[model samples]
Target: MIELLGKNLTELQAIIVEAGFPKFRAKQIMDYIYKRYIFDFQAMQQLPGNMRDWLTTHCAISIPEIVTEKTAPDGLTKKLLLKLSDGNQVETVLMKQHYGNSVCVSSQVGCAMGCVFCASTTGGLYRNLDTHEIVAQVLLFGSLLKERIHSIVVMGAGEPLQNYTNTINALRLLHEKEAFDIGYRRMTLSTCGVVENIYLLADEGIPITLALSLHAPNDAIRREIMPIGAHYNLENVLAAVKTYYEKTDRRVTFEYILIDGINSSIENAHELGTLVKDFPNCNVNLIPVNGNEHIQLFKPSRRQMEAFKNIVASYGVAVTVRKEMGDAIQAACGQLKVQHAQKQSE
Candidate 1:
């Protein structure tokens, strides 16, 4: 099926001309897809019956198929298991905030970056998603809500930088005024320190917020948890992050997951603070590790988390404990679709 969702105006125009329709008709279809967020061709009453039939027959306004949706009791978070055309499932989340609705999108079906603590990589890599599929996830959720999405976080099942081309293209399509109309600044891309992509992102200068999954400050601990750290190391990752800040004039966000006695000690906090001391503009986002029944790990107590934040704060590093979302439905940080998939297979 032909996917019309990811096409820009020019591409849509070309499709219309090729289909023996007037070029102006493409603008109408674009308006329906973007401005109206209409997925079913029948909803577009302005189009002639023949054109609608033709477009519906030849084109697919594709969106992710929801296999299941689990809404947390808080009513602000919904976790979805989406089945792609190939029958491979990926996760996307709709998070309701006072600011507005925010959606998190996955770049690949599964992840190859073997971050030991993550479930996305436990299944190993399947394949990278196309630009169309990535955009479809956003369009699927945004269209359903009928409200503008205020933010996007590319911190889902896969490492976004590993799928850089498609991720960037999807970002561009999502930010298009004719599409989801999300601004570039509202988007955040999280990476597990894929050093080269940091440099590449700096060259592009898209002005999206950069979130480094710096679960640990030193190379030793990071390497133990994240396989990528073995190759790039903490020093290399920080260097690239600094380069990114130098080029974009934007502060990087270091995501540190407080895995109960693993990387949550005061010593680690001091080390993390010192690591960011030179980069005073950078901020630390402390995340409480999300655990499951299979994993005996536990989330840190409120006091413990606060102590870590205060320790970093004392070093003059701006830091905040990231608010946990979808906890009732087990949607905390890495506990979304990944854990579910593991449960199903077992």
Candidate 2:
């Protein structure tokens, strides 16, 4: 069946027009899907019975099924294990912040980046999610909440820059006026230092915040933790990041995971500070490394995290420690999926 979720009005219009239906039928279908959160064509009462029947057979709405859900004690976070049509599953998160709700969407079934501390890469790379699959994630949550998600973060299971085309297309589709109409500025795409793709995104004209997972200050520490650092040196990565900032004028965010005895030391903090101090409009976000059933990573003490942040801030760079959220439930990306996999194995 032809997937209908990611196509724009022109594409949808062509499909219906070729089938001897009026061009306006595309608009009607979009109204039901985006506005009413209707996926099954048969439930579109306004469309003619024959049209609906045709859509049901010839077209498919590839929305993921929420097989399991976990909610935190504070009721501000929800993590869902979504099963795709092909039986592959990916995780999506809904974080309820004081300003508004933000949905975190994955770009692939499993990650290939092989970040040592991440559970998302345990299963290895399966496949990149289609544009519709990525777009469907947000709609699924919006349907459940009975409202639109205020913002989107492409910082879930996969390296979004690795699946560059589909990731970008999904964001563009979500930004369509008839669709969510969420501004590009409200979106943030995080990648594990895909230098080439970072350059490509800078030219895409989308001003989404670009987040680089720079878990270490220098190439030596980074290569030990993330494989991408070995492939692309810190200098090259920062050059690409610089180009992205110059082109988009959107402030770049560097994600540094604070593993207790690793990258959170005072020396690492100074190196990190010196590296990005002159970069225009940038911030360093220090996240405590989350431990999981697969590994025994450790996070620095609260005082240590503050000390690291202060050292980085002293270099004239904006820095902030990410507040822990969804502790009652498994909040780390891929943690829930890994647990579910282990249970099935047993």
Give the alpha-carbon lDDT of every model: 0.84, 0.91
Error of 2 at 70 (Å): 0.6
Per-candidate TM vs. native?
A: 0.94, 0.98
Q: Give the worst 10-residue stretch by lDDT in candidate 1.
A: 332-341
lDDT leader: 2
For candidate 2, lDDT tens digit of each residue in 1-346? 8889998888889999998899999999988888889988989999999999999989988888898999998899999999998899999999999879899999999999999999899889999999999999999988999887889999999999889999999999899887888999999999888998999999999999999999999999899999988899989999999999999999999999999888889999999999999989999999999864448788999999999999999999999999889766778888889889889999
lDDT of 1 by residue, 1-346 (tens): 6888788778888988998999988888878887788779988999999999998799998777887788888789988888888888888888998889999888888889887667677668999998888887787777777878888999888888989998998898788777777887899999998899899999996888899999997888898888888799788889999999888887789998888878888899899999888884799999887765566666788898999999999999889998888878766434656666668989
Clashing pairs in 2: none
- Tell me the deviation in Å of residue 97 in model 1: 1.6
User: Quick one: best TM-score, which candidate?
Assistant: 2
